[model samples]
Target: MSIPTGRQILRLYRDLLRYGRQLQFTDKNYFARRIREEFKQAKNTEKVEDINFYFQRGLALLKNKRVV
Candidate 1:
């Protein structure tokens, strides 16, 4: 797979944050924190293929939830 550019990664990160913000949960803070943590954990990932896999998975989940 082609490696994603910085701009693409930034865009996806923003989109995911936007989606997280729109989530309707009882504990919005917890949801937000989890989103933040997950992203933070993935921030240092070294493999482009792994990042792409995660990006695609996240996109699929967001699309399924009608958030994208």
Candidate 2:
């Protein structure tokens, strides 16, 4: 997929955090903290490849973590 726009990235971040809270077996706080730390680490990403990579990674994470 094309690199995600800023708004899309923000939405993904929010979704990840929201999904983390719904985890039944995992620790939600740790999941949330990791998601926050990951986004913070990626905050300065400027390269298109890096942005795309993170965007795709986030999508995969959300897909895997989301509760049905």
Candidate 3:
């Protein structure tokens, strides 16, 4: 898969940030651990073409931010 653009990555990162913030009052470790585990599972797949998709998507979603 192609590398995501800075804007795309930023967008994804923002999503993760929001999710993290939402979970802050709860169990932050659990949220982080789940994300980690999901990534790990994605890594195990044998399809080379799709290997980066999961990471790229995650990064993109986590990085998005609204300019104030």
Candidate 4:
């Protein structure tokens, strides 16, 4: 699998920050750890048509306020 770019990773990180902000009960640090775990998993997977798909999924989860 191809290594993900810094920009893509940063996008995912940005979404995570936004997601953390939306939470009322959970600590931001916990939410960030969750996002980081998911990113690590995605980076270990096989290559796909678009690298940004992972970030898109994360952003969608943030938009819906749902965990992976």
Candidate 5:
């Protein structure tokens, strides 16, 4: 499979942010910050496998009701 487009990636990011809001965390701010940091770390990803891996990982976390 091909890597997701930028818009698709942003949609996932937004979904993750929304998921963060939906979860009951003691430190919501910390959760949000962590999401931002993870995204930032992958900001320069160009490899298809790497990008899809992260995208699927995020989706799995979302589906399994966990955070990345």
Candidate 6:
């Protein structure tokens, strides 16, 4: 598997942030902070497979949220 480039990771992060804004939660700040924290924790990850898994998992979770 090819290593993901910096741009790809950045794009995924941005997309997650954007999608996170659509979450229908009472505490928007808390939700946003959680998302930021999750991404930040993975910032230094070096494995491409692990990164891809996280990206997909994050996207799935965001997609599952109801936009109320």
Best by TM-score: 5
What TM-score does model 1 achieve against the real structure? Answer: 0.73
Steric collisions counted per model: 0, 0, 14, 0, 0, 0
RMSD of 6: 3.2
Query: Which residue window of length 10 is worst by lDDT in model 3?
Result: 59-68
Which tens-of-lDDT digit does each residue in 1-68 have in candidate 5? 98788898899899888888877764777878988998999988888899899899988988999654
lDDT of each: 0.74, 0.85, 0.57, 0.71, 0.85, 0.72
Candidate 3 lDDT over 1-68, as tens digits, reads: 57545465445545665676665355767766766676567645666456467655565554563111
TM-score of 2: 0.87
- Estimate candidate 1's RMSD in Å: 2.8
> What is the alpha-carbon lDDT of model 5 when measured against the actual structure?
0.85
Per-residue lDDT of model 1, residues 1-68, tens digit only: 78777788777777777777777753657766776787788889989888888778767767896432
TM-score of each: 0.73, 0.87, 0.47, 0.57, 0.88, 0.66
- Of candidates 2 and 1, the better by lDDT: 2
Off by over 4 Å in 3: 2-26, 65-68
Model 1 regions lying over 4 Å from their true place? 66-68
Task: Tell me the alpha-carbon RMSD of every candidate.
Answer: 2.8, 2.8, 6.9, 4.1, 1.3, 3.2
Candidate 5: misplaced stretches above 4 Å?
Answer: none
Instruction: Kindly indicate the candidate among 1 and 6 with the higher TM-score.
Output: 1
User: Which residue pairs come into collision in candidate 2?
Assistant: none
Per-residue lDDT value at 1 in model 3? 56
